[model samples]
Target chain A: MEQKSNKSLWWVVGLVVVVIAIYFAATGSPNPSSVAGKTVKIGFVAPLSGDAAVLGQEMQKIALYRVKQINEAAGENGTKFEVVYEDGKCAGNDAVNAFQKLTSIDGVKFIIGGLCSSETMSMAPLADQSQVLVLSPGSSNPKIEGIGKYTLSLSYSDKKTGEDLAKALSSYKKVAVITEQNEYNIGIRDTFLEDIKNYPSVSVVANETFPKGTSDFRSTLEKVRQASPDAVLLNPNPGVTAENLIRQLAEMKAWTGYKLFGQLAYLLDSGRAPAGNFTEGMIVIDAPNVNSPELLAIEEAINKDQGGTLNDLGHYYTASTLDAVDLITSLITKDGNDAEKVLNDLSRGRFKGHIGDIAFDGHNFVRITLSGKYLIQNGKAVLQSEQ
Target chain B: MVQILIYSFVMGTQVLLLALALFLVYSVSKVQNFALGAIGAGIAYALYFSISAHLQIVWTILLTIGVSVVLGIINFLLNERLTRKQEHLFALLTSFSFAIVLESLISIVFGTDGKNIIPGILPVYEFGVFQIPIPGLITICFGVMIAVLLFFFVHFTPWGRMLRAIAENSFSAESSGVDSKKVRFLVYIVGSFIAGAIGILAGLNTALTPTMGFQLIIMAFIAFLVGGVSDIRGTVIASYLVVLIPETIIGSLEGVSLNWKMVLVFAVASILLGLRPNGLFVRESRKS
Candidate 1:
């Protein structure tokens, strides 16, 4: 019995030693929690392996490019940066886990990430309590504005987009709205409904909402088809869910001579391509048009690191990511590593970015780059210069 | 009304194919076969990869079927011992864990994005006011043919009798010299093949995601439960009911959306089961 106990004790000790070794090996650093002077460790949370990974991955590449430029400008003896990446999977639970790991385990005071609104919203309460400065590159939900004092977004809110969409749709006599029950979608939805009241001639024929992860929309589509609306607004989040919605809607070859309006989902070719020509001439309401030759050149240059498919979605997100890196790093450089102080100065600071000018109002959302409308032509949402 | 029927049947046939696979596996193993969903998803990835590789159509079909057989064998190996020992709860857990493992592995290999089997707009067949895509038509014909053939096999053939006998009483059937192990293995392989074929068709009809199998299997589970687990024909009826009830209710109602669809389906199924506990087609005798 004594010998058996001894053997089990040795096994436990061996397992612990192996776990410690793996911890050191995986982190690939000497004491990951400790950052030497002149080196800034920033935590990055993004959907590196889910339906929305394309967007997150592109933001990551742009972020890395910006970091490289900053570090090179800083020189070898100057303040260098290291980013610790965690996969948020575009879900709330996973984002919370990533945030906890980055804050508690990796010991990061600054986090740049969580491109999806769901990811950013989930990590807000924790960041507020922990005093970790979280700067989201592209989370656009209006609810994100007041979520936390420490949390801030480079992307503009969906509130402006919602009103912009209503104004664009004011000419239509009838409109049907189909929205996904998600934070970002709901933000736009509530605002759009409220603003649609301004258009007395435009009446909503059918108002529908579906839960997330719902792939089959045959019944919803059929019912929407029956409503005989002049315009149908497809409001699903960008990813597999959006693709599924448009694909199913296309499969039911009934909607002809009807206008299709969407948000981020239809604005990206990857999300709308599954619907084929069915989405042609559709109008997409999303971030402002940042398709200048200068922006396009930067987009192509940054996307080269990601096999050049990163811009398949759009270039506005790239601009936002560059501005986020610039804003956060500059704040940290001017102000010390104090997260609260950095966050405070960040709200007041304004700088020129790829999207032109960047500034934040009392609300944490960036006040620059209002939403724009695009007309889908030849399977792409071209910027409607008129809008 | 005709349009609703067309839509329901188009969706129903795919669910029927999935439910039939579930029923076939349950008839032999006496387990819920939760892994059926992941297996379908794995095969979907296989088809996507094959298409991406630009393989010949015949080779792609054969490779997909071949992957299905291999997946079936792996599933059988994972659960065979527990099932033989009659540890059904453990076997069910094993199958469930297998599903998780397969889903995680696929997500790691292929990522969780949706992929299209046929990337362009599919041609639609118009019957008056109803429009059914080519894939939907193929699913209907193939699903109906498979269902009829399976019905004949389960009701008329000797192998199906062995399956029924084993399902009814495995020990007794084994004592009567029935090789229950071989029959179960064969059933699992066949069931997986059916799942893989149906998975390809379903992906072609819509889009392929790692979680699609779980969504499909849920409908199949509801169908098989509402009908009779032991009766395939009953499952067929229940499949259509599960889809049509919600489709009809949500379609006709002015304010109702698709969110209420699952609620309406469950309510109707509960009411149906309350009336006929044995199932829609199952006729159980009550002894005085």
Candidate 2:
């Protein structure tokens, strides 16, 4: 009788455990197939907060503006678009969460953005596995092309930017390279180095990589000053390192003699740039200016109809978001209810975008000819004379 | 090299504040307060808002300390109520939960945007090879002053003696008419206030963010663990060593990255911890 009672108690406990587990599993897990409507939902993931929040916020604002314009233009049949903005936060775990949430909870068929290259790289695998058409607006790292065929970028690749920079500095016989020892910085530096190799006259006199978030660049500056190259290539993005490097270079009087060549990271807002003549002669490679007359006209029309300025640099992100929306609309317009067909169309088609015409290679690499190298003159970034 | 040393001194002020907090809690209450980092982050956010709005720095620092003290008191009360009968592990879990709560609250309130504090004080000195920002130098001097004040308070005061007694034997201290609970509460409050001050100093030195505490917490933990948690002098020495040694070693490496340098620190710390569970300076007793 005792043994029978014990077995009954165990059975009850097991049933309770199973019921609780089932309840949690059902409630906690998201349903991914619930999205179906006239309005196509596109997910936007970017680092909306943290150290890179400024850039992320700009991207978010731009992306939202684009979606509003598209929805308004549909004028009842323009294929109404729904956008879900998720904060990637520029961290691996957060990127994964953003990807998972967009895919599962939102059931977004397409995703745009992921501002930082780091976040994009982290989200690439999840995007590839889920077969979601992932488009990055600001991620410029070349390694992103290797992630999968589903990943596409609106920005110029590191290699292309490097080659452009190399061409810009081709006249200089001796050059010094100082970059942060991170994947992104190293990628740009390596690409630039390789491109410069083609020009035998340009020999890298000094190659140095400093720690990111470093406050003092005196030692690094001293080394570069000693090398006394015709030009110095700085590949660190805008933050503590960039600020410190510029300050140290100015302090050491290296700015007077050597030309400064930097990556896109150096083209910071007016406030972050150094004071006086520190940035006058520096050149940087960045995305093509979308503020051109042709682009501005389109932006003005969009703003007139949609009530937001396309002149806003952040609107570039919105343009990228719209690209995703357009891709989805085109897909559905062609073959409704066929996700496979939509993915295949995206994989095969070439679309003219805000940056430029974008088409994916078989390796999932998006080729865009929007890369332009600019020089800083009087605190303004102007396209290089050659360009 | 002078610039590196100066930067290390500025960095050390922040580390010293964290070390002092950890030292107070461990030496007086026989507990580790993981919530120090969260408190620091919270205080930083508060100071950022105050400074941006053009409020007085004095008022801001006071408010930050007041809020931190309240949080510490609440933490103590919760630990007393929830885990008084439990072991050290349970106390640690309680502190960890409080830290998480503080972090999440900051995230919810601030929304995770990093705020850059415009330093009120400007750079006062610029040598040929180095420049010293007045605010950072002030922070270092302030740390030294606080350390001296804390030393005197702990060694020369009656409350300090009572705190020592409680730390040595809470039951004995309670039996001898010293209110152990009161001492514990006070220690927590003081410790949190120190953390708040450190947070403000860090904000002045660098940008403030919700997750900044995570990085500071690791450095603080290393400083405290290496210093011998219960020894103040040891912690101060360890703080400088922790910052300068890794920085120099990492600086010396030709191609090895900062990420790898961090890994090396963690590896070394792990080995040290394995050999000396009580820390390098403090000896662990076999009997509780």
Question: How many residue pairs collide in each prediction?
Answer: 0, 3
What DockQ does candidate 2 have relative to the true complex?
Answer: 0.10
Task: Quote the lDDT for B80 in model 2.
Answer: 68
Q: Please give, as one word, the docking class of candidate 2.
A: incorrect
**Candidate that would win on DockQ:** 1
lDDT of 2 by residue, A1-387 (tens): 999999999999999999989998988744342223467777888777654565666666655666676567767554566788888876667888988998899897677767777778888888778877777777777888777766777666787777888888899988988887655677788888888999998888777776545544545555455566899888775544455566546554423578888866666643225434677778877665555465556556656654544332333444554565566666665555345556677667777875557677554556766566677777777777434
- What TM-score would candidate 2 get against the native? 0.82
DockQ of each: 0.42, 0.10
Interface RMSD of each: 1.9, 4.9
Docking class of 1: acceptable
Q: Which pairs clash in the backbone of model 1? A: none
Q: True-contact fraction for model 2?
A: 0.12
Q: After superposition, how far is residue A138 of candidate 2 from its true place, in Å?
A: 2.6
lDDT of 1 at B91: 91
Q: Encode model 1's per-residue lDDT on A158-264: one tens digit a residue.
A: 88888888987889999999998877788888889999999999999999889877866777888888888898888988888898888888877666768889998
